[model samples]
Target: MTKVLLTGASGLLGGNILKHALANKTLDILPTRLGGDFSVPEAFRGDKEILPLDIRSQTWLWNIISQWKPEVIIHTAALSEPGACEWQRETAEAINTRAVKFIADLCEHFGIRLIFISTDLVFDGTKGDYLETDPPNPLNFYAETKCRAEEIVASSLHDYVILRTSLLLGASPQSLRSLDERLKADGEAGKTMTFFTDEYRNPIAASVLADITLKLASGNNRSVTGLFHAAGKDKVSRFELGEKLCQKYGISRQFYKGARQDEVTLSVPRPKDTSLISDALLTVMNFPMPSLDEMITALP
Candidate 1:
């Protein structure tokens, strides 16, 4: 069995990846260095080992590397939420960039395959149709760190895959509560939502993204050790995504207005377009890409 060390086990993407990895018992998954807390999902509870780690500290990292000695490392740990990352700049830089570099070095030393999860926000919402090869124009420190990590991962190990994903959905127990609070506050305050019509992204269901992530991890690319766009097949505007949510849950759409990018108060600039479509992801499963509406409406 190939031992895989999964970082950021508490995050939406990391949690979902843990779910998918569980079904395949042939793969040994060790959930480690979860940032804040350890909320083990049912899928990973009985079958896997949970290792509490602090990726930022070299001492913490060395301990795990010495013990786990994993054959492959999937880096999902990050201060991903933009506002949180922005507010906690030091923590963000440490985990997203510095810790990731540590993992990359370990991967190189241990001769293991590395899979690093990145984001679409690396582009400052200026260009829409971004490819793996496109130059990154990060708007915030969070994005800047992720981009830096991507560069380090690309160059550090000869065998690694750098995947950039979009916003994650699908009822993350942690994330859902936050979303509900934000939406409820907005609804109650009668705050008019000005979602962008011009800025676009292809937000993939978290579950789907997880499955694709495993497929890529299972087949660690040697020749394809570079950046990849891990997203849905079609692109939709933020306005469309919000509208879909309101319609799906039967919320009043009165607060929603089709606004352009310039109208939004983005603390950090967002990409005007960051829709990622890949034949690589499409090839692994028989599932059809779910539109934002279907994903929202079918919420369990």
Candidate 2:
């Protein structure tokens, strides 16, 4: 059985990945923690071995990697929230930039296949449908850190795949609510939320990302090194996504407000359209990426 180490296993994407990994008996999944408010999903309580991991601590990371010697490490733990990242720039750099470098260096020395999960926000959003070959021009602190991490993995490690994904939409564990779920909860609570109509993203299901991650990890695609844009098939605005979700789950769309990127001012500069086109992944994997409606339909 292949041994795999998964970081940020308590996050929405990481939790979903952990769920998918647990189902595969051939792989031994070790979930690790970095920091943040995260709880182990009830279903994964007895199934996974939770380890305390501080990616920033080089000595600790080295010792753990040397002892466990995992064949693959899916790096998902990072300061993900754009707003939070903007507010705490130094902290974001420590976790997202420095920690990633530490992990990549270790992975390089150990010859471990590392898959660094990145965001579509890495692009400046001057244009949409960004390809793998497209140059990254991050707009804010979060994207800057992520972009720096991607560079470290690319230039430092030989056996690495940097997956730049789009906005994710799916059901998370009961302990942690997903973005879509949060929106729904806010609406139900009679809280009006303004979604961006000008800003767009190729949102993907968490399940789809989990499946793709596993496939890449359990493979002989040594030639598949470098960056790959993994996202959904449709390009939808935030407002449209919210409207669709409301219509699907019988939530009220009246509470949903639409605004353009220029109309609103945020602490951090947001990309106008970071929509991705995963043609390389699509051609290689030949797997179908579900549409927004399909993702909503499969939601529990």
Candidate 3:
């Protein structure tokens, strides 16, 4: 069995990874999380213990990595929220960039393969269909940190896959982790939600991403190393996605409002169009990237 170390087990993508990994007999997965109680839904927790890990602490991280001696380490833990990252720059750098550097060093020392999860926001959004070769021009601190982390991973590890993904839409283990869950929560709470009509992204299901990650972790194809893009086929705005969620969940349209990027005052500047072209990874993996409609339909 391939012993895999998965970080951020309580997060959306991490939870999906754990859920999918458990069913695969080829993988013996050890999941870890930080900063809170086990927030992953009980349904996804199939007798697996989620260990506590503060990736910011080198000693704590080293203990886990050295003791576990995993064949593959999927690093997904991050200060993902753009607003939070902007407000707390130091904390964001510690978790997103510095921790990744340490992890990459550990992977190098132990001869373990690393699969790092990055973001599409690394681009400036002037261009829509971003390829793996495109130079990153991050507009926000969160994206900037991820960009730096990507460089660290690339320089530190010879056998690593840097999968840069777009907006995620799926049934996360927690209520607020995925787009559908957040929208549904807002609807149930009688709150009107405003989405940016100008901003665009090729959002993918977290489960699909997890599947691709496991394929990399499975070690079936070692040639699929280096950077790749993974996202849905369609380029859609947040307003369009919000409308779809309303229709799918039977929520009222009155609860949803569409606004341009300028109309919203955010802590960080959001990209206008960060749509990714995932053909590079899709071609090699022989997996079809889903459409926006398909992604929404597939959500549980």
lDDT of 1 by residue, 1-300 (tens): 768888877667777778778888667888775555546666544556667888878878878877778878888888887778888998899889998888888888888889888998888766676777678889888899898998899878788888888866675535442333355457667777666798788777777777766766664433355567788666888777777765555568777788886776777656687776655545544446666666555454
TM-score of each model, in listed order? 0.87, 0.95, 0.97
TM-score winner among the candidates? 3
Count of clashes, each model: 4, 0, 0
List residue ranges in candidate 3 displaced over 4 A. Answer: none
Worst 10 residues of 3 by lDDT: 36-45
lDDT of model number 1? 0.74
lDDT (tens digit, per residue) of candidate 2 on 1-300: 878888888777888888888888778888888765556766754556678898889998998899999999998898899999999989999999999999999898999999989999999999998998889999998999999999889899888888999877777765335767887787678888888998888888898999888888885554577789999889988888878877776777677789988888877899899999998987787777777788988876
Worst 10 residues of 1 by lDDT: 173-182
Worst 10 residues of 2 by lDDT: 170-179
Highest lDDT model number: 3
lDDT of 2: 0.85
lDDT, candidates in the order shown? 0.74, 0.85, 0.90
What would the TM-score be for candidate 1 when compared with the true structure? 0.87
Q: Kindly indicate the candidate among 1 and 2 with the higher TM-score.
A: 2
